[model samples]
Target chain A: MSVEHVVSFDRRSFMKVATGVITGVIAATSPLAALVPSRAWAVDLGALTDAQGAALLAMIRTIAPHDALDSAAYALVVAALDKDAAASAAVKSDLLTGITTLGVGFAQSPESARIAQLKAIESSAFFQGVRVKTLLVLYNNPIAFAHFGYEGEAFSKGGYLFRGFNDLKWLPEVPLADSGPMPV
Target chain B: MAQFDLNDDSVAVIIGSGAGGGTMAHELTRRGIKVVLLEAGGRLTPADFSQDPGAAFGQLTWLDPRTQSGTWDAAKTSPNMPAWHCKTLGGTTVHWTAATPRLQRYEMEARSTYGDVPGTSLVDWPIDHSELKRWYVLAEKRMGVTRRHGMPGMPACNNFKVMYAGARKIGYKRVHTNYLAINTKARDGRGGCIQQGFCSQGCKTAAKWSTLYTEIPRAEATGHLDLRTRSFATRIEHDVAGRANAVIYRDSQGNEQRQKARLVCVAGNAIETARLLLLSDSARFPKGLANGSDQVGRNYCHHLTSFIWGVFDQPVYAWRGATLAGVVEDENIHNPTRGFVGGYHLELVALDLPTLPLVGMPYGWGRGFTDLIDNYRNLAGMLINGEDMPQANNRITLSSTGKDANGLPVAHIHCDDHPNDIALRNHARQQGTKMYEAIGARQVVTSPGSVATHQMGTARMSKDPSQGVTNPYGRSHEVPNLFMSDGSVLSTPGAANPTLTIVSLALRQAEHITKEMAAGRV
Candidate 1:
């Protein structure tokens, strides 16, 4: 159970049955994947055509829209999708077809139309596929956590010991009986 | 530390070094008994733990395939991975939140008190609560549990503050940051809780009371405990008279290694323990080892649990402290008026942004789903740990079409909720909502039925040999020299967490075993 062991799971086919868990090894294998011929490895956004990258980014924003994250954070997810698409040509084709069939360009469409289109394509393999892998790349990022008002990284910061761990002001006072010298 | 020779027959061979097995090994070794502890998983040190839940989950979760059946929501939500027990050196204790609640007095005598609840397999423990009280105290002190032995309680994190405010508003009296096996001020050799909030993922600071830092190491220091990790026990070989003589396991090199044993103890969690018993069927005990009553794999219990999240108007930063902070103990007292025989405790559960989506709901989308993640700071969570009734049919059976890496039939867990469990969950839901709404909560969301935190009663204890697999001392009724030192021997699933009870029973079992050994009875 180290990060090394988790990376070892990249070779396990049985472990890839789940949606969210399939996002394994992208961080570890991405650099190596850049070495493979463009025909096999899809590790960079440069490998993805302009329409494919825009459509995937559009899909990711709909999955987890944030007002605060910089364009770089959004670009990180596009890179992740690009990696998956590079590995499977069908994935790229599916993304393109799904975006085309929806008949509303994600970047050009209004918020309501985009939302409605995304909801309609919820059952598609393209949407479900990206939804699982995209979140792993996006939400798990330390940058996204800060933008979303979350303090995700804890163990390395020597934990929240003297931090604002107990600083809550919204709640009312607890009776002394509840906070007794002796445990109940 | 001295390693026991493979041919040595005088040493005790204990399988699966988790809470029960590790504790028993430590106690036995400290008393000058030789013990060879075999663990199926690798050693994941405190240094290996990560702050990220996603990465930590990969490190801690048991990914070995298991097929789940039955009406329980976990069956559908997490079919392949039913219970979230860690397959590591310290077993599930490495991944556990370390919530150690003692069983109430009435919980031990479920059959006598509950009385003929339709469609269930209720039974009383061979031993009572009074018999375990001394051991429980010892376990608490040893683990440095908060609010016990004058150990200061962990500070109330933002999540716990929400729990306290709500519990107080709802007039819940028996509530505080209750018993936790976490360091508050650096007890023993380990440092105090740094408020890492990632105890669920292996504790990197060694602040959690896992055998990895505590018992297993202490046992090794005695030079009487031989700790072998990544050695999977496949069979317990017996002599001509049906007493276990040796254990056949796959070592780290994937080579089969057989170690001679004077006594054998099985603590591979409920599922693996039962499966090992069933797989060890012989001409003498045709059904399985110690399965004369056909009761080895019966009566599996996963506590009826529901995770309730309360979204507030202000930032709560629920994940700022420990994964779990406090408990609401007022509801732990049994009352028949609630239409359930047992009671439940509400414990704090704070999932971060990454896990909230995967576990909070199976598949969520649209603005509502996105909003949940958007307002992650404003949400606080509590989990209901209610006792589930044991049913004879809810069991772990070998799959006909499947086999694992070692060619053993895959374990298929069939869990069906009893009527009492359903009724109790409904009751908890009603009370939980009121408790949250009392403090001006905006909305309450029930997490997807979870992978079981507690699993018990696959190999139950009973005075009668015909009714159970093990005797009062956790010795096998059929196999005199064989034992089960784990939660699998629990007679009934208590509302409280099972680790404390499992450790107490292990201590009691070790005493009985040592005496038996000295008397030449085992």
Candidate 2:
């Protein structure tokens, strides 16, 4: 995929960006930028290597992993990391600590090795704290997760009504019974 | 006349600015009192309301739903049951389903109809339902409540026809939709409800009775009321004589500030109200302001709520209209045959949205589920929102060492949910499951434990000072100028939602305070 010949898919195409190219796919000018915080452009995340960014994405992906429908989870995490890189030193340090927790050599490691590292990190108190903080802000923000994965909230969209959208159904019926009051 | 400075200099402070708080501010300020209305939450507008439940869960709700704290942890806390509340300018009314059913006559004195259950503090209200009838009408207008009257499927009158007919077949009367604080047609400059399935998420269209659209603005319009949002009251300031003289608060910027007032109103919800008064300890009143009887945070009650969800063969489009349209009240009064002191109202509450199926539906696996999910449209359900008898053990106390960011002690709450409450819930659950079967539901699922929205009874009102924390007029029995007007003021927990009751009492209390002021009694 040459930069000049970047193929444009419909709104749905953004959901299927490749796994390894997630960072580039979710860069500032990419569709995934919409998922990051509104003030993400202002923060400086400090200097991070490709390995550091990959490790951060792997950790976040485990927390809100992508489903089979190509939810583009990895892309969204990359965008968030890219924006976070521009944040203050404190935020930068927190991001580095999070990346290092999943093991700094994540980019060079195999997928299985990276996954095992993530599993170990999950048991630690520091990772639990980071997981809670990231999820709290992400779940509350619809666009952030919507760019990467499906949320129960998105079922309200028109497309979700019927056509086999898992959550939304058109004119879904629920019957009622007036059994009067209980025999008390 | 008994006047101590009520002019521009006299800080006429009204404690809360929700349904009752905002209404009181409008009423008092309209009569020319410089008022300061304090709300512990942030100020919000209609635009601030989101259709997304996830967003609403964060801003309007007290605790964030996604966090582990959102779920009740029985292992960590004693007597664990997560009590849900709203922490916004509109209070719980902001997220309420807008069912405005008035209490039936028997609800006030359930103790007389059925023998009291031990370990329960069931009592009669000092005032009767008729006393608040006129006030109910007033509250209806203030809230801009509307009804279709005799229209078909109008909920109270018409929609109950099908359910009532079934009930009659089983020897019970019909049910009907009660009055609700929602717009039927555009009234008082707010749009009518679009039936958008987002009332509980905070009505984004200004179609519901949230303080954002009504009394708050009316109070603000008078220029007599100054609302300080995000200002959590740390404690009530006491005078030399141990009367409430001022309110000490922590502002949004976390700065300490004190405002002087002739009379102080504590309208924060039950838990916050008790915590504030108890924290306001002085050398003259060490036990806490107006808490000499140690009844400030005692006698807490939340409804023994339960639900029956049914999966039917056809779609009813349950989420199309109000989450609640009508209710059956036959079992809502006292009935000893059921072995319970009080009764419960079976509300025909419909469900919609993805979260309902995800979070509320019964969890299981396999082939049978596909068929049930295919018929998700045909699932009508009934929920039991029954009144629970108050108990002293169900109290809110302060943790000795735990504190919030502002240095205020954390509210350590515990409740020994009585066996009678459990028994009543069991009976209701059985009845609900049967009703689902009667309605042609293929499968019925019941929630073992109940979630409650109607929290009350911490600071009760009574004619005798020893019997209750506040007098009939909501004034403190011990502190002359201190007043309370939230769920904490209910002497008896009614079967219906508590927001309507709280508003009516606040309206009555305002009248009481103004009358006393006019007669020079303050």
Candidate 3:
């Protein structure tokens, strides 16, 4: 369940990191960063600074808090936002301004204080955009899918026909004849 | 494989290729008539369909920008998307649940059965039930529908088992896996369903009947159909004699092309069908083609729909079977004692884990929301497919400002739920809660209605030309050679899903067109 054990970073992605400074920010100071493995897979950030990325991750985790989930799942949202922000100047400015509005040390603040700050600006476009993107990316990730016991894509495994499609043992068995007459 | 000349005036031009248009193309081509079928979207085979819900939605959905103005929940939640229908070659049939319930006699005669319902434009179908019943038999046979014509019903899955037991526990008798146009055993040259559970994602196994793999291909095999994919029809032009003679469309390369026709049949579902007709306005027919009565885009109806979920203590594995394979049909019968003019069916429904939070549940975040996702394996779901009253004001009109990629005015949909629709939904929700509670449900949650998938009654059929856009056979009252072959011709939004009726009407329309062509009338 640790973030270090879940995320695997290849050499190409490690080299793609904009600077060693951002990697140091994630690995050294961030509370969640302390759990990073020795080969720490610092995510590539094109439009967001290391502090902005950390705040965004904290904000996402606060929005969709699952105590059982790893920080790697929340980091995926920041990665996606950074990618969007890199593609659009409007998105970069929005994220920068939105993070600035959250005030400094937002990611370092206690959970209750962070929650109160988020509540005050819950109606803002920035919060709504980040929330929708987090929901889309986080729950659809393999980490969330595995944690929730969701068997994704049955067709590749020959579907659920023989794999307990009708194998509910808790309920009384429904008779096949209960389907009634065939149209003649 | 057939390629008709663009100037060929001997071919019938059919617009959209879902159940209605696809079936029409097959029937006409088989009868030795040449056809030029125009579909706005590109074609995709079962092999191209994705198991991922998000990817499949982008691939198959009609993502064209549409405007919405209404008091319905969709107007607020999905302001840009008022209706949900496919734009692929098979149209919405590619995304349909394949439920094939026949319309009851009373549902067709809404005027006689629900007398004097104020603020509604209720009208009896010009074609009687007995007449349409004949074609329904043919449509069912053609589609190899399970639970009909000696075909056995699909095996009960965990979702269906939960629904059947709960429905029976609540004193309902006529509950079973629904009559679906999917195979239980291999028939009609298609494989049996392996219960893959993504029935809406274009039916990867081809076990579910879709025109993409069935009628359209069959029409191509006959060598009498010129199937044009990615051809967006802009307008229908007519001759001086007031007969539809050509269709102007944008081709795949964004080039404008006009294909001449002997006649035209429009089957672009309800919204697009109405919009296309309105877009065809000419000096000769000022308001729009075949719109002499100004009834072309009036009386839009999408059945009152909502999802009701029951949370159980144990796993139901609702997403293991066909997406919608169970039904409770007893409530589908009309009885004034139920505090509604019409009735509704409670059909089993299940959304995948990724989709459940987005649409199945009320919008929320944090622990309260994550708790529901944690119980995703224990949720049993049902959908209310109830009759929604048709208001004359609930209609499709051309947006004055918004234009599509092709520079045509986008359709603006306006709908405000009638009181009867609200009542039917409330009653259905209560009954659904009781059924689940009878079988030991810990919690019941009801969701707001999603976008209209069962679109109908925009361009309706009527005995009086002033009351409707088409005649009993779906032929336009103003133009002799123009016909509407889709759900747009439905006189009322019956409790049943509109696909079966849409197919039946297409079958009947094809027969009528063949006869009319032989007699030299059209």
Fnat of candidates, each listed: 0.59, 0.03, 0.58
lDDT of 2 by residue, B282-311 (tens): 887787778887877788777766556677
Docking class of 2: incorrect
Ordering by DockQ: 3, 1, 2
Model 3 lDDT at residue B250: 96
Model 2 chain B: weakest 10-residue lDDT segment is: B66-75
Candidate 3 residue spans exceeding 4 A from truth = A1-14, A19-42, A110-115, A180-184
**Which of 2 and 3 is the better model by lDDT?**
3
lDDT of 1 by residue, B117-189 (tens): 9888888888978888989998998888887888777667778888898887889888887688988776699
* True lDDT of residue B111, candidate 2: 60
Model 3 Cα lDDT, one tens digit per residue, B1-522: 999899999999999999999999999999999999999999898889988787898899999998888887678656767788999999999989999999999999999999999999999999989999999999999999888998888788888888888898989998888999998888889988888899877798888999999999999999999999999999999999999999999999999999999999999999999999999999998988999898988999989888899999999989998888889999988898888899999999998877787667766676776777778889999999999998899999999878999889999999998998999999999999999999999988888888788889888999999999999999999899999999999999889999999999999999999999999999
The DockQ for candidate 2, computed on C-alphas, is 0.08
True contacts kept of 2: 0.03
The clash count of every prediction, one per candidate, is 1, 27, 0
Best by the TM-score measure = 3
- Provide interface RMSD per model, one decimal: 3.2, 11.4, 3.0
Candidate 1 pairs with clashing backbones: A42-A86
